[model samples]
Target: MLAFKVTTVGASSGFILTKEAMAKLNVKKGDTVFLTDAPGGGFRLTPYNPDFERQMALAEDVMRADRDILRALAK
Candidate 1:
């Protein structure tokens, strides 16, 4: 696991990732990455996905069969 310290960025807080971590996330400078809280109470970061449309197509079928519960999740 990689450890990061919260650092100041012009009056806001941010974490700095090393070049290796950036490579693993498939992103470069100014690219958006998501940071979500883990089940164990830590944080997880990942690249913003491009295949979401395809995944949503599959989810739409499931959502239609059920209710729109899937929409409860924030995009």
Candidate 2:
């Protein structure tokens, strides 16, 4: 497990990720990472957005269902 030190960031608390952690997460400086609740009372950290994935899935469904109409509209 990787450990991080909590530090104060101008009145807010933040943690510094080590180089190894950043590499494992495949993230770089200025990149956005999300911390989400996991099963069994743990947390998950990932660079992907779950909500955006869901939204994109829904959009794909709509696009597939309306392919004929969409094709006509493109003309």
Candidate 3:
């Protein structure tokens, strides 16, 4: 597991991403990260939100369910 320090950002708060962590995430300065509540109680950081992923998965399921209809129309 990795740990990060919460630092003060003038009036707000933020964390520092080390070079190693940045490398692991394949991102650089000006990039964005998503933070949300973890399962237990803490927080989590993500490149993509789980909610968005869930919606995308639902869309994929709908498309897959109509695959035969799509193929017939594509012909």
Candidates' C-alpha lDDT: 0.78, 0.95, 0.87
User: Mind giving the per-residue lDDT tens digits that candidate 3 earns over 1-75?
Assistant: 678889999999988899989888777899878888999999877777688899999999988999999889999
lDDT of 1 at 5: 96
Q: Could you give candidate 2's per-residue lDDT for residues 1-75 as a string of tens digits?
A: 998888999999999988999999999999999998999999999998889989999999999999999999999
- For model 1, how does the per-residue alpha-carbon lDDT over 1-75 read when each residue is reduced to its tens digit? 667799999999998989888888889999988776768899777775436756988888788876655666633
Off-target runs (Cα >4 Å) in candidate 3 are: 73-75
Instruction: Arrange candidates by TM-score, descending.
Output: 2, 3, 1
Residue 68 of model 1 has an lDDT of 50
- Top candidate, metric lDDT: 2
List runs of model 2 lying over 4 Å from the truth: none
Candidate of highest TM-score: 2
TM-score of 3: 0.72
Candidate 1 Cα misplacement greater than 4 A, ranges: 39-42, 49-55, 58-75
Residue 8 in model 2: shift from native, Å? 1.4
Candidate 2 residue pairs in backbone clash: none
